[model samples]
Target: MGLTVVAGMLVVVGIDVTAVQLARTQLWDAADSAALDAADRVDEDRVYAEGLHERVPVARAGVAEIAGRHLAEERRPHLVRSWSLGSRTGSPDGESAVVEVVGRVDLPIVGGVAEAFGGGVTVTVVSRARSQVR
Candidate 1:
């Protein structure tokens, strides 16, 4: 009986760990896709006229729009907590931007045990793309 109980607990732990890792990986892929999409649509005229400093907000908005679209399509049930965008100026070579999207993933295993913890697992993903001034 004791050995069986231990084995069962171990299995539960393994499942939880796997779920967390999978959730994190999915978030990262979504972020990457969103960042690339936004980077591809960057307005060169705006960046050039306003300069990298002032263009950060514009680029950030682009990224957030793309990221939110993706998240809504893929993870609608998981509420997005925050979405942030950052611009890397004076990179010696050129300008670059980064988009970070964070949200809570309702892990099956965790949700099953929500009475103990009270909530689900939180996952965060950050993706960066270099601005192509063309």
Candidate 2:
């Protein structure tokens, strides 16, 4: 009986950990997709006026808007309780799009009690993509 109880507890813990990891990976995928989408969105006004430089110029506003839209539109994993745009979602060098996505994951077994107490693990992921004139 003791060993059976221990094994069952271990299984529950393993499932919880796996759920959190899966949520993190899904969040990362979202960030990567958002970054890729933002990378292609160059500042058209700057490009038209100054011509294409060695690297495509990515505007901060464009990156933020694209990332935000992607996050809003894309479907997220059920394990993820909620997701929001991180502050670092922008173009750092005017050439690359950096996207940061943040979310909380709820464990399978303990999630109910923890959520009732307003507790959950936070996950954050950052992804970057750049475009070149070539």
- Per-residue alpha-carbon lDDT of candidate 1 for residues 34-77, written as tens digits (9 for 90 to 100): 66665655555666777655223234445556655655666433
Once superposed on the true structure, which residue ranges of model 1 sit more than 4 Å away at CA?
46-60, 75-94, 131-134
lDDT of 2 by residue, 30-126 (tens): 9999999999998988899999988999987899998999999999889898998899989988889999999988888888888778878999999
What's the distance in Å from true for residue 109, model 2? 1.6
| CA-lDDT, candidates in order | 0.57, 0.91
In model 2, which residue pairs have backbone atoms overlapping below 3 Å? none
Worst 10 residues of 1 by lDDT: 85-94
